[model samples]
Target: MSKTILYARVSTTDQTIDHQKDQAEAAGFVIDEVVADHGVSGISTELKEREEGKRLYDKLRHGDTLVVRWVDRLGRNYQDVTDTIRHFMRQGVVIKTVINGLTFDGSTKDPMQEAVRDALIAFMAASAQAQAEATKEAQRAGIEAARRDGSKYRGKKPSYDREALGVVVDMLGQDKGASEISKATGLTRQTVLRIRSDPAAADVTLSRWES
Candidate 1:
């Protein structure tokens, strides 16, 4: 029988394996198994390079389902994400996301449906890469500003980290309410609202804290 497998890349201390599993369960996914890579950088490491991530190719079979918190967990960049998803779909594996509850499969023979699915995959992969790039840029900028201003001007540390900020941003993009995003991410409602009002500022704040 085909099983549902949850794949997670835990990049930060706050983003724990249990937290991801809980999020998936909360999202209503009945996971049969879980494969995760701790301290894995989704932006720097390809899924195939991860110790547990590599298991996905061997563990998954035809008709099995692959679940992730987001498409970003599959690859490092736009091309990698797109290629990975297409490869899995071609292998008759259905891919699903916990956040948006998106499903992609190769069962559809309709050309229009295929086209739409492919387009959406491309868009999501691109958006993931864009968000990664933006976060990196914000960190660089924040570090430079901190260096220029010195310790005396360093602002108060942010309550949330980069991972939390990303979650908030994703929810905000989906037009989710601050209270909802806060509850989902375990962040304060005020923090969610601050991120919604100005994501760049939120990013900078987190970056400054890191600096």
Candidate 2:
């Protein structure tokens, strides 16, 4: 029998995979298994490279189904997301998203059906990619504005382990963008921007926190 598997990822401590499962269950999907990756941002990492994502490849089989909250949950870029879906489709696996109830199957042979399916996949994948970029840009802008206003950072308090913070500083030295650093480190963009805006202050904050 084909299994319906759910894959969920939480980029930050503030998020939960349970929410993704809840959303899927509410949508009436009978999930046979759930694979979750914690403290990993889908926007920065490819699905196949993620820890739990690797498990997915081994578990999914022909005629099985993969369900997610959205295409962005699968990948952050157009090429990455579509390529993933196409691979599963070639395996005779169906991909479904709870948010849109999207169904992607490779069972169609008609010219028009094939064309429409490919077009929709391209459109959705592009939309997912664009949404990720827009969100990252907005986050960076908001952080920059907060820094300029000399106001406290907005949203949940930024927290990270010492090692992760060190990675942030190292990436900053390499002149990476705040959003990129945030995504790469799984740290909040606001925290990345704050550190980027004032390394001295960040040093003092780190010293105080360490003490």
Candidate 3:
């Protein structure tokens, strides 16, 4: 049997995979597996290059169904997003989005329908990418203004506390999976990787951050 898989991504700690899952469940999806990549700049990182994304690609099969909250969840840019979708469609996968109940069927035979689908994909993907870039630019402007003021500027608060992050670090050091750590601590997989990249630094910064 084919599975219904959810893929979610967040650029900051303020975002939570649990919420996305809840939203999907509320919308009546019996999600079989969730693949998430956290703290990655969607505008910059292509989906295929992400660690969790790579895992997702490997896990998906011909008959599987892929679900996302939005087209942006698949990718930030138009070309990357469309190409990724095309690849999945070629493999006989069905892609669905939760927000508007959007479904992209690569199996459409009618020329008109195919053109419409392609055009829709292009529009949505472009919009997603534009939004990401705009948000990034706004954040950059805010940070620059803060720098000019010389104020203590922490962009967003950390999602995990010292204790929770400590557990994540411990689990990571034990070579636990990102999904495992994310589920245990409610931290995003990207945050897990960031911590794993430098546990000692994370510990020190988190310690100071708490104080």
Candidate 4:
């Protein structure tokens, strides 16, 4: 019998793998192995590079099936995610996801079915990639909007320590660039520049350095 392999990854220690596993199990997959990589960002890291994730690639075979929570779980970008799934399909590996109960297999001989399946996969993968980018853009826009009118900002209360603000001011006083101040004080360049640009508000809250 072909065994179902579960691949789960969390970008940080704070993220739990149980949620993903539960989703897979609820989808009726009897997981034979659970491969997980912790604290690895899906945005830039390739699935093949992950320690546990790499084993899934090597161990999965023609009769085996791979399950993930979503397509985004498989890869970070549109091309990368689509390429990885297509490669597996060509190898006779069945891909399934909990989100949509979608399945992709290369065993079908029907050209029409193949074309339809491939097109759907591409569309869904592209949609997933676009959603990820949209989320990032939304986050950036929110930050920018917050910066324009600090009163409307609803972020956490500023808690920048006195020492860090002192370093930032000293860096500015010395004519050190934002990048240099970021490196020296462990504050982001954006934070350094924000402080330099608005000393009054920066001194009051130091909001830029809080996060």
**TM-score leader:** 2
RMSD list, candidates in order? 15.3, 10.1, 8.9, 6.7
- lDDT per residue, candidate 3, 144-179, as tens digits? 988686444544567778789879978877889999
For each candidate, what TM-score against the reference?
0.71, 0.72, 0.71, 0.69
Query: Model 1: per-residue lDDT, tens digit, 19-103?
Result: 8899999999898999998887778788877899789988988999999999988865998899889889989999999988999
Give Cα-based local distance difference scores for all models.
0.87, 0.85, 0.87, 0.82
Ranked candidates (lDDT, high to low) = 1, 3, 2, 4
Candidate 2 shows a clash count of 0
Better of 2 and 4 by lDDT: 2
Ranking by TM-score: 2, 3, 1, 4
Off by over 4 Å in 2: 151-211
- Global Cα lDDT for candidate 3: 0.87
Q: Taking the tens digit of each residue's C-alpha lDDT, what string does model 2 give over 1-211?
A: 8999999877766668888999999999999999988877767788899999999988899999999898888888888888899999998999999997989998788999889989999999999888889999998998888778643543443376678878988998988899899899987888888888887776666655554
Superposition TM-score, candidate 1 onto the true structure: 0.71
With a 3 Å backbone cut-off (N, CA, C), the pairs that clash in candidate 1 are none
Query: Given candidate 3, what's the lDDT at residue 10?
Result: 77
